[model samples]
Target: MDDQQNDAAGQAATRHAADRVLDAGALRALAHPLRVRIYDILSQYGPQTASTLAEHLGESSGSTSYHLRALARHALIQECADRGSGRERWWERPVGGVSFTRPAGARTPSERSATQLVMSEFFRHRQDRLLDFVMHSEEAEEDDWSKGAMVSTATARLTPEQLEELSGRIMAIIDETVDRHRDQKGERVRPVSIRADLFPLATLEESS
Candidate 1:
């Protein structure tokens, strides 16, 4: 198959894989720095061979190959059909996106740690991107930028119940907006990421 066809197939496979909510173990598997970097590359550039990734990351092809296998085992990625060469295998992320959902009645320390690790990596990635964008803003056009770019951290006086209610409202707004654009079609309409993060900073007493 041609490269374009291969890329389209790989994207379809990845979107299909992302449709499922990952389990705790799967989240942990995806939390590794190398694995996350691999996903970021695939999301930006489509399917890639382990050798290509190794070259990009300055790591050995064997090491990249191993991490690719681990991601596949966790269902985060899958092997695409190899090009004409039998030795060069390509990999793609399975899902268009990943969401972490905690199971009810969770009590295990290991499970909690897994969740924390995934979240920490996610925030770290976000912070890095924000810093990069700010550092490069001189080269980016201001007219093309959205005014919704701002980061703020503050302590709010709210009970747990109030916080949950606020979170639900925020999620509803996000869902409504997403649903409105779900069927949009145009040359300008491409998949854009919208990340909304809401979490408690600390207990009321601890913050004070």
Candidate 2:
């Protein structure tokens, strides 16, 4: 995959982007663990074909192809018209954030189930990535990355309004930084995962 082309596509996609909130159908479509993995790979690594995905996933090309088509039917993934030839199709995830948060309404049991599954798989994947990096950091961490890296945790108490405000501020900073550097390419440049997680922990009473 060409990094520059991928970044250019990402820049264009972000320029016209609105966060995609998964509907019940899309939620169900992505509830499978393999599908979630496929989606995550494209998001993190850029465009790929079914064969390439299978190579990364340790699954058969036929199996990956089937899931890829299922995802495409829901417009969660699309064929790269500029990249594929004949039966060899290249697929890429459309850039921008995808929210699993349901809108204000009553959701069916199936929808709720789908939501849980999707969220579970997505978070599990994130956890695996974090663990992988930590496990190999001794060998993989270059001087620059090690110096630039941060891994810390802090706890704070705040009201819902305060928390919301803080979250908005954090996201604004992230968005600005990403927008400014989304298209950056250089000999030393690399893809970095920037994660932000902000949520209220359960009170002692609630836990009990």
Candidate 3:
């Protein structure tokens, strides 16, 4: 089965852009790894119940329920109607997804702490995903499987404005491709993540 042809159910998951900027309160609430994991699963897989989420994440229902409530408190997620007559309440990412920024100057200790904690989680999550794939790539023991996973680096010289334009175009293409194939499904298809980073290396003068 072609990789993209599979994962129709995963592709069917609603795509929500991050429209809501997180305030300090929301940032603090999202700083926990478990909370972030919960949010990621819900956002990627669509609506989920605490019990179901707990099962997937290997946590207790009570623990998952607590984190779900905390996320809901900041409106990162909202309650949805139950599936059938089930007692478990389903929750989903808010209509628009969530976002964050470092706090402004004159920050309180709590504000600084929250931002640091949240950013740490962000880096950890990204690195962990790549590391996990690397550790398991050989286990797949297939050319296609190994080739399917990869990392690439490219460098270019350009003015700030030109760089921004280039980045925008590249990102647009990626987004379009992902969206076009978002809902495809096949037995061999599986979920994959695409991450991109573009930044200018610091010049000696700038460093000084």
Q: What TM value does model 3 have?
A: 0.76
> What tens-digit string does per-residue lDDT give for candidate 3 at 1-208?
2444233322323232334767778888987889988887876677888889999999999999999999999888888854524567889885444556654541677877777777777778778888888888788868686787767888899899777556655555565667687667889776677777888999989999
lDDT string for model 1 (2-48, tens) is: 56544554544544355566676786777678887887777656689
Each prediction's TM-score versus the true structure: 0.61, 0.84, 0.76
Clashing pairs in 1: 14-94, 18-95
Predictions: Cα RMSD each = 10.2, 7.3, 7.3
**What alpha-carbon RMSD in Å does predicted model 1 have with respect to the real structure?**
10.2
| Collision count for each candidate, in order | 2, 0, 7
Name the runs in model 1 displaced over 4 angstroms: 1-19, 82-85, 102-107, 141-193, 199-206
Error of 2 at 117 (Å): 1.0
CA error at residue 14 for candidate 3, angstroms: 20
User: How much lDDT does candidate 2 score?
Assistant: 0.82
> Which one wins on TM-score?
2
Compute the lDDT of residue 148 as modeled in candidate 2. Answer: 81
